[model samples]
Target: MELLKKDNYYHIYNREINSETVFQDANNMSYFLKLVEKYLIPKVNILAYCLLNNHFHFAIEVTADTKDVNQAFSNLFNAYTKAYNKQNSRTGALFERPFKKKTG
Candidate 1:
């Protein structure tokens, strides 16, 4: 994905590792959204979101460019995966690597 330059828009989505459900409950989903708010909201304006049983999506408009925008997203996913794993007694990657993205 591009660095999410200011004023550009992007749609980002990712699925769970294997076919496992990433969001097993409401709290799990809420926590993931919280991670997004905590991490990516600083870098972009969240326009929409879709949280499913095994995958998730986000639409964002970049507010500015600093370092790599992907890092902000990476931080969001990594933080969520860490907490989800600990809470679920699982030990491995949660979302698929290199989450997908598209420009519009």
Candidate 2:
């Protein structure tokens, strides 16, 4: 994982493990965004976002020089994964190993 630089834009993305559906229903999408707002909104400014069945993407700009940027993302995914696992009655990794990012 790369350290997110302040004032830089990035294209961030991740996919569900084994191409399984990450969002089972509309409520799952809402819950995922709520988690994003809780954990990532303070760390980055979201420029755009798209959520599909098995993956999601985000265009964002880092707003500050904070060491917790990566941790915020980890927290966001972990929280969502936990809720998703519990709700779906499944276990193990929910997403791919490391989320991907690119300068944009």
Candidate 3:
């Protein structure tokens, strides 16, 4: 589990279970990016990121008086899941966990 305190940076990674292709093509990846910009970038600081077929990596920072990182993550994940499910006609969890966050 990740404990997000104030003024800290974390290395975060999330993977699709069973190594399924969460992002099948460039268009899917683009859609995910659109959702991130629409919902995530405005809320938190995303220092670095790399998106792959079944997972992604992120280096991010949180404010000192932060309240909920989970909510922010959920918005992005749920939005992507909804879009992916609608596009691919599938239903299930997109990520394996609550997103691993290591503070540094």
Best by TM-score: 2
Ranking by lDDT: 2, 1, 3
Q: State the TM-score for model 2.
A: 0.95
lDDT of each: 0.84, 0.92, 0.80
lDDT of 2 by residue, 1-104 (tens): 66888888999999998898999889999999999999999999999999999999999999867588888988999999999999989998899979999998
Can you tell me which runs of candidate 3 are displaced by over 4 Å?
none
What is the per-residue lDDT of model 3 for residues 11-88, given as tens digits with 9 covering 90 to 100? 878888768998999998899888877766655688998999999888888753455665677888998988888898
Candidate 3: global Cα-lDDT?
0.80
TM-scores, all models, native as reference: 0.90, 0.95, 0.87
Count of backbone clashes for each model?
A: 0, 0, 1
The candidate, 1 or 3, that scores higher on TM-score is 1
Error of 3 at 19 (Å): 0.8
- Count of clashing pairs, candidate 3: 1
Each model's Cα RMSD: 1.5, 1.0, 1.7
lDDT of 1: 0.84
Model 2: how far residue 10 lies from native, Å: 0.4
For model 1, how does the per-residue alpha-carbon lDDT over 1-104 read when each residue is reduced to its tens digit? 34557788889888998977889999998888888878888889989999999998889898857465667887888899899889989888888877888987
